[model samples]
Target: MGPSITDVPKSVLQDVIIKLPTKSIIMCKSVCKTWYSLISDPAFAKLHFAQAEAYPMVRPVDRRSVSRNLYLVEPEDSSGFDLKDHDCNRSRVHMNLSKYKLPVCHPEELLNYHRNGIVMPSHETERKVSMKITQIDDNNNEVDLGDGFAFMMQYDHNSYNLVNSCNGLLCLSYFFGNRPAAVCNPITGEFINLPHGPKHEKAMTLIGSGLGFSPRTNEYKVMRILKEQTPDTNKVAEIHTLGTGSWKSVGTARCSDSELSFPTCVKGMLYWFCDKWSGCSVISFDLDTEEFQSVPSLPFEDGYDVSMGDLGGSLCLCKVESFEINVWVMNDSGPQKLWMKKISIHTGFSRSWPRGVYIPMKYFENDGLLMFNSRLNAFFYHHPGNHSPFIYLKLREIKYSSSEAISHVPSFISLKDILVGKDVEILNINSRCAVLKLPGETEALSLVEENASF
Candidate 1:
């Protein structure tokens, strides 16, 4: 008789299971009692987690292949690279769900189905293109509300807007007219309009806002710091919770007009850089507790503007000087001690003073690297630093023009046709649910196989 199949060494089995796709791992849980026991080991799970974490959440090199030419910029040297050519390429490359090999269903699918296959836009739009949406569902077909959904928030042509997404909801605010705000679940096509607050005269000011979810209560909240007209008063911070339907005030003592920047939300709290004429501090607001606290000044010399972002899972403060950028990652205060690492800056542009430029750091799920840039009009897919040695996306050539008027120019790039690259891989996974890729497999090939049966 042939040898029993179960004779494989435990070490060999572990290696095989670890290399399998996540879906396959779940399937192997039912293969046999031994296999199931091996797969369910906490130590094995931790090893897999460490392996996954080793890869960069967002590979800086991968940004090179991302398509950056979405708008038509009208530069002086318009050597036949006009709007028509750009539109033609956009139409040709516009993502089609049936064309990619996605492992999981997209949240957009459920959102569209709820709306008769129409994804709702935050702003009114006449331009319509056919795009498929996919909803994420568990084994039981229930929605996964922890990972947030992504969707479009439309605004006027020349407006500044800021968006911070957390826990399946997005907080969107526009910096034109009354500075309207809204909370939207792109996956559910459900959005609640926020009450417009008092208007401000300064149109060029940066409006800081963030969205966060409270797991304890399952409630969502939005926070904004607007420049108050009465700069001398201490009423600059404002907050709005999803269920409350209106803006509320957070009373922090006012600092000098030039010292306040938009707040960055981390760990259920909103933080902002505060340089009161007396000293520099980081002001934080705990949304759940409704309490305010302040952290000591960042480790840096004077005269540098500090910005906050998420690095790995911790909060990081970035200080940029001429041709140099210093990033400090805050660590545990006791056991490990506070560890700060410096990322040498290669971008040569003089560190411009923090203005109303809405730079929101987006943490990619693939790797742990934090991604963002200073260009407001550029889409999130493009890299903005000059040291990257990649072709610059000419904004003039790719700028969007109104179909009706020859000279009607818009302020912001219309992202109606833009596709988040993350969605492509996700949809591929949902459809197959168990396809394993070898180490050297190309993304394009994986995408091709993902869409083969769809």
Candidate 2:
């Protein structure tokens, strides 16, 4: 025998497993049954995720925690990654990335601003909805997420929305069975359905919804806005707290004819661009208080094509004013302060909206550079306001869809750990090899329990 069964102390063993990264933990699962049990414990994943937060940037995280500031491009074929942009002299760098898939009606990204490399694609055939996932590494390799079979593998539904993603959790807008929504950890192959709410008449149907995290309370909340689409209708807001499993009325918000914008979380509030007001402007929703507020108007006329985005840990507004794109940041939080215009660049546009537009994607912290990507070009601008004013910048012959591009550092915070599981399944499995299987195939996470050993 290699060693006695009781030779090692259980306390010491516990300490060792919690210190390893996600990759190491996955490989070690196959080493032995005992090791798999320890690493697979939901308690251990929670402990490791919580303790790992204190890790400093100096330590080399060999684990793929996502690139610091990488831009994602979707070629017309929706398969291979392109590298024609590496010849630039800006601080932005390019790597040889491979292909991945987005599971939406449009070839657009399902979630944005959330820092996790995991992406879920849903394919429905003959009435059953199959959940397929892929992980895009820094190497551009599309890896499988975990070792679990299809979720909602057999269900009678045709319509669903890939609602919102924060941390490593995905919020499905569709009501599974009778539930209002389903919150799933695509990484762990574990999902919890939210309790169902009262069905409304056709007049008060749901028009828009979003999810956000409160750093202060350390809780995740889903905000679903229901509207009648009538001229004098008042929009209703329903808030769902993860642990409560119930959606509570957060009071109705008044603003007719306004459309909801993509949700952006900052500090403890959610911001979005909307025409739901007299003028098309940004709106704010508080995470802690569950209240809604309208942000002050940006310094622009009513005719400019404008959008809101998160830049450098703050809320930024981009407007196509005159022949240049004006980049502005909110100097203060909440509904106060004026929009500060910082960078201006001439990109050959006029009063009309161009056939394509450049959306701000990423901001480099180590260096002061901002990058934006459009349908046919990827551009970067260095801040400090001392460089040449929109001169002959570098060009790359890469092709991406006109869809939205997003960038963030991937994190390993488990959805199960964050939302404490009571009747939930905490299977001892790994995410790296829990590959997403094709239609009519059999696989769960990475492997079936009987065949855990590779």
Candidate 3:
């Protein structure tokens, strides 16, 4: 045999390990103590997270489902595309949320419980909601979570209506700020519940919310735009850091009263569309300095439904006309000329087409496919020159009404590592469906191979 891996130099070994994906890195930990020490380093986690590719996390658009499951969208050949059936082309890796029960706490109920100050769930009862997660392949066959892989969560939210994914953590909350938000790593099953913000004196309308990470400070922040129903109809912003447990006023939000759209976080900036007297312009907020700036305005005409998304790390604007959809990508430049129309999909008002504004979700770089979602259905479009340019793939609607998809990158960083001294609930589920309380530093990952082949 050749030289052993242990014979390699420390510097060379690290360079190779950091380049591997998160699942493989975890497996390397059990190989030996040296590998474990290297992979477990906090610095290595950050480096690996920065290099990981993002995948789309698809879920039910309608939040009425009693049991919501997270789906990983994978692309297949055009042969699976069917005009009659919507669930033929794509395969999903289901992360079942039905097994775990979310602790229900509405905003009003939590306010009343604050008379004696809100108390966290006791440690003895924290293990009540342990759950087992299984992976289903493209052939619809059930498989184990994987070797040395497990998933668990100690949930503490009523509903996951408002979801903002950044880095490797998901910011889950109820729409209109009806409940406290929880920052959770679905892959690791570790979560921290944020304290509710101060109650506003005047009635406030939630315009939009975003979760972003600041690499400069190595901190994650949540920003909320609330429009006070006052005479001026002015908008103000509030920000909450992960471990702070309180929100501070962040001055005014510069945006007019357009229809509310979900914000997208790219790099360290959060962007959303806002109506202007001239037309509609994109507004961006920097997570590091906590400053807001206006991006170059779009050149499109008014009176069309618009949405924002991140395509290949650049800001993409999706405009939906009567039946056609145009996806424009903007290079990070100072002028407006950098914005170019990337994908133009013309789906005539056919009988099979869902009649609603389509929102551009994610763009598959290697496959040259762009995915769009609407209130009623979801469609995947391959750029010109590919077989079957326009294909519709609707999610199986057994229990849920509609579905929504967003891009998410999984990270191996533990919440306890970031929020030191804070009490984080750890839930562990093995391949046998056994529930146990693992140590804080323990890692449990479920591997799902992402395929976007033609």
Per-prediction TM-score to the true structure, in the order listed = 0.44, 0.58, 0.67
Indicate the TM-score of model 2: 0.58
Error of 2 at 427 (Å): 9.7
- Model 1 segments more than 4 A misplaced: 1-160, 177-180, 196-208, 225-228, 259-262, 274-281, 301-306, 332-339, 346-370, 376-397, 400-454
Top candidate when judged by lDDT against the true structure: 3
lDDT of 2 by residue, 216-270 (tens): 6788887777776567677778887776655777888654455565567777777
Off by over 4 Å in 2: 1-92, 96-164, 174-180, 184-191, 229-231, 276-278, 333-335, 348-357, 366-374, 377-403, 420-454
> Per-residue lDDT for 1-454 in model 1, tens only?
7876478898888887776544456578788888878876766765655543211011111111211011111211212111112321321112111111111112333334345744333123444433432222111122322212212212121121335444333455543322435544332223445555444444323334566645455456666565544544334566665555356667643344544444455566666666555556566677787666655556765534566655555667766556555567667456542538645443445344222222324333432122233332221221223222111211121222211001101111111111122122111223222232211123221001111010
* Better model by TM-score: candidate 1 vs candidate 2: 2
Error at 419, model 1, angstroms: 27
What RMSD, rounded to one decimal, does every model reach?
16.5, 13.7, 12.1
lDDT of each: 0.39, 0.48, 0.59
